[model samples]
Target: MANEQTSRKVAIIGTGVIGNGWITRFLANGFDVVAFDPADGAETRARQSIDHAWESVEQLGLHEDASRDRLTFVSSLEEAVLDADLIQENVPERTELKQNVLAEIDQFAKPTAIIGSSTSGIKPTELQEKMKYPERFVVAHPFNPVYLLPLVEIVGGEETTKEFEQQAYAFYESASMKPMIIENEIEGFVADRLMEALWREALHLVNDGIATTEEVDKAITYGAGLRWAQMGPFMTFHLAGGQEGMRHMLKQFGPALKLPWTKLEAPELTEELQERVIAGCETHAGDRSVAELERQRNEFLVKLIDLVEDYWP
Candidate 1:
């Protein structure tokens, strides 16, 4: 699929964090963006968020025609999606709410337009059930700070067409993203499932008073996180197996899989555990506001992205 005139315009249905991230990414890629959010001061907040993130995207490299002025805030969802080639839905995670929004988007968006949901856990089939044009829908789940992070897990539902999925892949690739097409539809897809497993373990550790949140954060920051930043878990373990690779590693460590080292379910979010986790994080963060922390993280990711490109197999 080639980039056509229609693909140059995108509509963002919500102006929350994920929506704003999508807006920034589309704008930075030189796409004309039309945004609709009924919440008061949405346009102003989105503009501010973009302004805050503009420097990072510039360092990451902007398209020749990329300009903040290309964005337009529309008054209605229909107005936003009417001329858009891609309509991204980033409303809250509530199932019924998302279904209603997607229904409206499907009703308004052009038949050729692709609709993507930033749902982290919901299956594409469930999200597209209420849509009249379900075949055009896909779950395009992305991580936080979507502008810098290249990974976007693209999953199509049972009703989704292969042609549209290919078009969606090309569209996301054109935006300077690494879009991975997942063949099967599953809740939480891949990345989030792996992350959720770790999250449950982390919560269990805190609940059992095994470690503070800061300690858990450090364990990742200095250990597995570094390796994961370059090669994923599989590749890292492949190296661990030395010349034999995964075969030897699996044979050596296979029995450990049945050990009780990890918990499958999340611990209860009791008030004491919650306060401890919160307090520990606040202590670690100290005086750095979230914006400040985000700036630091952006700087780190930009450099890391370059390194990943240089070393990626």
Candidate 2:
């Protein structure tokens, strides 16, 4: 018999960075998680990563005392999916691969199970077509370090029913996530499109030698990001325009939008550019292991959340 106290049985089918993050998130939220991965020694790696993530969650006061016992990792994908209420697929981003994996899982998943893809850019419709029960699948994409971030974008495919989408939205909210449901299935969804635009311009600036990686990071972190942490872009701009609001700001600065701008093109990941980016990051993040940096980032995020909660309350 399933544990009645467990909110849901979540199966994470890939114990990579994103998969492990999902495991921590579900477990922290009182979900019983069964994780699967085909990679050699994946169970050990997943357990280590989850333990580390839980340690940070504990430090940040995000996890309950019993969260550690709620998480369990399974060896086989079938075992992971068995009797799960929700299936979060964090497999590598590849069309053919995703198609194959979803097809295989569809055979075993319960009819009522909702399968969500953690894809950053793939359209839900494309992935759903390969499934036996298309309407059961949707995109429940989360940002990196899912345990800390609250935003989960919920997108429905063409075959996705309103009822299923609503259930998904409620499920995320119940797990303490702020889920925004997209009305239509579009490529890149919402946040990724915004990020791609910013990324394109950032890359253009970097390639043109206008700013170094550290300089770009500072420009956002020190200026816009501080406000963004508290409010969204439009809300911040609303305050910027005083009583006049967004319309006034648009009238004042909209003309500058016509200036020669970056072409919305993703640059090839050339060896030179990759090496420069990696080296620059290493230089900027001196003397810290990946684990250490993640811990520090989570701590800062928790402090920011606490400040907002107190001030806004």
| TM-score per candidate | 0.82, 0.80
Candidate 2: Cα lDDT at 153: 96
Q: Candidate 1 — which residues are off by over 4 angstroms?
A: 1-6, 265-313
List ranges where model 2 is wrong by over 4 Å.
Answer: 1-6, 62-65, 261-313
- Looking at model 1, the pairs that clash are none
lDDT comparing candidate 1 with the true structure = 0.85
Which tens-of-lDDT digit does each residue in 35-72 have in candidate 2? 88999999888888888888766665553433667777
lDDT values of the candidates?
A: 0.85, 0.76
lDDT score at residue 177, model 1, on the 0-100 scale? 89
- Give one digit per residue, the lDDT tens place, for model 1 in 155-246: 99998999999999989988888999999887789999889889989999999999999999888865677667655665455445545554
Estimate the overall C-alpha local distance difference test score of candidate 2: 0.76
Which one wins on TM-score?
Answer: 1
